[model samples]
Target chain A: MTWVTFLGNATDPKIGGIAFFGIFLSLVVFLIGQWLFKISNGFFLFQPLFVGMVLGIFILWLLSKWFGVALPTFYTAAYKPGGDILFWFLNPATIAFAVPLYRRNDVFKKFWLEIILSLVVGMVISLFAIYYISKGLGLNNDVISSMLPQAATTAIAMPISGAIGGTPAVTAMACILNAVLIYALADILIKVFRLNSDPVGAGLGLGTAGHTVGSAKAVQLGSVQGAMASIAVVVISIVVDVVVPPFAHMMGLF
Target chain B: MASNATQAKNQAPEHEPAPILQQMAIFASVLFVSSLISPLFPKSFPVPTPVIGLVLMYLLLATHIIKLYQIEKMADFLISLIAFLFVPSGVQMAASLNVFTEHGPMDGVMMIVTIILATIILLVVIAYTTACFMWVSRKLFHKSTDVE
Candidate 1:
């Protein structure tokens, strides 16, 4: 009814009652989001984070069309200042994945030969599939760039999208899409291809592209895959770091 | 590698340095602090700071500046929470969809297409690199075995 409700208000409210209200509202939203995330994810489909983004987008799209309203934000991350504060919160959580990263190091060290070869094989397969699909569907550079880092963890992918001028907002969407698509389809693909369910096999597939969400899926598969996925998160991050900037600069898009 | 991983990281490796929980706490704190601090840095590039934080974490681990035990708890928690973290972002999709409806569809299709194309190109590189590494490794392995 009000402008606040219609256009979405992000005016800086005073830090007291608004603070309590913000926290309470955030908590409530958190719970509901958690519930939706879990319901789709309860069956252990891809990561709930991925599903949440898609579902959120779909919900927002429907709401606006039906009611002529927009969702609310605390900060102007939607338009200015920076990315959504929620993204900032998610960014910190990325660090929480140090265990997998550490284990990945151990796995790579131990099975250096096997890990390398298997990773290469997995990497090739995932990339080809993505490239062909995107092209066949006729997507543009920005969307594809965002999708390119899909398999990498979010912490790394977000910037990868940002680096080459891929929209973080859209990159955020791609991150979710990649996580969901891979998380949902990985096991099937593995089974379909008759790929070994070994740690190296599973981890390479998930971590190399699925990012952290994929690693979580790998954990459900087995510890070895889980460990490798963690390290892959880091390794892939490193890979992106080296690969993105030079490529972007060379392309002269910058 | 096995010996280093299982033995070096074992909690009771004959000379326990700290409680496991303490180790985990320290590790988690490092991750959290690093993650928070990363976004604070200058963003000269289009990429966000969290990516920088990831690289920094990797370097710290690789260089032995921050050992695994210290960060295990944090790592585990973050991985576990990965799915739930996207909720707020999901909510944004709702609004973006509406904006398009108001402005009309395909308003940002070009932006979308460019992003999608970039992803394809990046993946092509990743796949190609992976294949190349495999080929080189195999070549080196064969050469080493012949010499041996």
Candidate 2:
């Protein structure tokens, strides 16, 4: 079929036209984001994924306007087909985390005690900190519940948030916000905190606070840092799995 | 001889990536098994399905059931796109923007500040504590465990 014919059929929910258009737009938007990132020399605001999502949403809104449909309906009919398919891969992508974790098992083996202990301690401290901080700021229980699991990566955090009566969408936004802030401010934080003395600690901090994006930055730092960051992601997720539920129950969040 | 095998394993990914078809088959099989296994976990603590898959993959690699070269390229490719895969969820934020603005702007600002402050605290605590512990342990037992 001609490209015009295919695109013209986008309004019909049953046809693959809108699905293909959604995928095409996502990729093109991603490429545009990458180009901006490259030109801006790695500015955090130009983060390709963030830029792509924002731009993609804006375009989807425009498409809805052009088609004279509500945003939600248009997104459900047109964009969600391809978007859901891309989201499905997040599961396998998460599993792919094992590659680096396996390669870096040596670090875990040697420093298991230190790594686990420090993370557990930090986890407890952060849990209390998040709880009190939110309460102090007069935020409601739902927001507090969402923030509680923010230390974990997005995949793991969302389920825990939902179980504990929190909004998974907000949980995701908090996760990405934490990641972007860490990615942008890591260098300065390291300098201020004197984290240069321990790459492993720095890496773990990045992964625990920032998730995969932080790990991406960790990879840029060095192999050891990359490995540690990967391990930290796994450990922190496991910790959140074990810890957040009980903590939430005790706090009456659930 | 043992060291030589280790060296070869380490160098494998640098040689060439696995073919696309092979990578797809591996990922498909892994996901299938993980889907079957994830439902077995208890309800109170719902460990994510992908995490179960992660553990499964780690075990396979650790026991040499799957070598690094077999899935290295595919893993890297997927991991790199992690940020991209998250975009849809991020875009969903557009729908929830009212959550922030429902209250006055000051309430929203406070919530943002709370999240940022809590994060900064988490970062500092984890980094410093981990570093201090590692340093202490190394000083006590200098058995060449230093990552540097």
Candidate 3:
């Protein structure tokens, strides 16, 4: 009915090239969200990624509700392929994290024991807490399994979730939500606990609970803290991957 | 003149700016190789392609097979844009709206609150425990240098 075909034609890929357009639009929306975040003086609630997600969702909703376009049509035409390509970058991006770890090799060597101990303890606490909380909440086993690996990065969490009979999408959501929570509240927790004095412990705690976004916060604290956070993300992720499956299986969780 | 010559000999070569194209190529090649190997393992395997890619890249850097300068720019660029890569996944949360609706908004709020509280408690406990360990180890080892 309308001439705004550039948005996408659900049936015709060649007419609109909506996959590429969707990515371009998502980036534009994200940049605007970033600008809003900056103007808000770095409010965590205004985090660009979260804002972008809300905006993207709203756009899809609008197309369906107001324009009379079906949801499935819009999804296949735009979101799926665009989202898949962007998601693919997550793999290489994870590998790139090693650069920071390599750059701070000295810190790793200097505080190896302390760092490893903190991560292991933190991870155990996280898994236990999730288990008890989910049980208390009366969540099903599948939901509990998905929520178990929320502390790890998405790249690592998804596989562990799958292996343990969890939903990958739910796991991804949990991981992102956890990161946002940590990013928003790291300072409050640090101040309340008097954690400012020990940067290595602080970084490890943040990364173990919060993952990459938490590491971003750690970077602001100092280089050693950032490096420690980077190491925690990788080490804790690997440890969780190895430990969660058999542990869950043994516990009859899977 | 002899001292000056010796100094010159000891100085390392000044690293030229790495070509962006080459750096990108190297980064892409490494990821490509990783993706190729990722599927060789069964789907049941918990280890993912990214972990393998990360290890491969780290080994290359540590072994001097790939200089930091060669991949530094591309790596940093990718890392800085890392948050962007998560946008689509975050947007996918839209699909879970049904879950929230089915459980009721109160339950959803309670779940989130519980998660946040648990995470904060976990963070504090871990930090304090680590500090205690460090202090105890320093005292036990009688190596003040070990604490820092």
Candidate 4:
């Protein structure tokens, strides 16, 4: 369904071929999704990747309605970049992040050692392990490292991949995929391992390894974990941005 | 001095004014510091201020100079906003129709394949490492208790 018709498809997504209303429809869906986010007990914070995907589905149905095209079938293969209207709605997001960065000043300064350590270790193990193992598996480098920062934030991960000659598109894609999968899998992993299930433990794992998606999982575990996870996301994204490229260059891996 | 003496009779909260104002102050401080110090890091860092500012926050919070409860709502607020920020990029990915014809299947194919493998392997390693740390910390905690 094309976005142009997303009042459940210009009053009916099945009626495809609304032609030029695609952007308009995406805007409507984005507004609805944003509202849903505000009202949904804050579930999207933990499951952003899934939230994005759910939005995508609605968008696909709407676009299909408007454009007379079948919705993209393969989940991984589908590609439309959503729409311009959606992008516009999201632009205000950077304004909202100032809260914690302000209050958590003490945590950020004192925990520098841990934050840096975790991000470096997390990115290194994740990136290289994927690279070498995938090479052993006969997959290309881009395929592996694209998932490297999957555990990291998108803004930093995308360009880091690009600088190191990895695939930015895939990096973006993998980050989303990991968030969804990890958010789903975190509990089982914790329970299966009989892990301590402490907030710090859950938070670090979520922030360092799980990224935003993991944080979502962390929140479900408890608020302390959520706090840790949130801080971790910011720290890891910063670390990945500042450290990965030069480190990648120094190692001559690119 | 007078307020300190009066505190024995009735406790007054010195640290927090109200949740909202404190949150605003915290936010303002971080943004200012991050913008000022962001340049100390290399060009590759993804975010502008909060990254550096976060380092500062961690230091203050851990030292008892700043308390977590003071900024709880503010922290939650940041987490809440994460979803909306990525909507544009997510939408772009969900909507781009001619990607195969435009970017070609070879690079895109290779890219998707790599991402899948990386994510699976990453999850395993992270889970393992976290368990290891938890084990180590527990063992160390026990050892310290025994010594005491």
- Highest-DockQ candidate: 2
How high is each candidate's TM-score? 0.65, 0.86, 0.84, 0.62
Best by TM-score: 2
TM-score, chain A, per candidate?
0.64, 0.83, 0.83, 0.63
Interface RMSD of 2: 2.7
Poorest 10 consecutive residues of model 1 chain A by lDDT?
Answer: A74-83
**Fnat of the models, one by one?**
0.31, 0.61, 0.52, 0.23
Q: Tell me the tens digit of each residue's lDDT in model 3 across B1-148.
A: 3343233223324556489999878878888898888778765544567767777887786666877777777777877886677777666665565554456776666556666765776577667767876787689976452322
| Model 3 pairs in collision | none
Which regions of candidate 1 deviate over 4 angstroms? Answer: A1-11, A15-68, A72-89, A111-133, A140-168, A244-254, B12-70, B98-148
Ranking of models by TM-score: 2, 3, 1, 4
Between candidates 2 and 3, the one scoring higher on TM-score is: 2
lDDT for residue B72 in candidate 3, whole number 0-100: 74
- Report the Cα lDDT for residue B111, model 2: 71
Per-residue lDDT for A1-254 in model 1, tens only?
A: 34223233334443211223222333355566457657765453433444455544454445444555444332222221222444555665655555555555565565556555545454545445555565566655655555555555555567767777665556566655555555556665567544332445556556665566667777777766676666666666555555555555554434
- Cα deviation at B144, candidate 1, in Å, is 14
Error of 4 at B75 (Å): 3.0
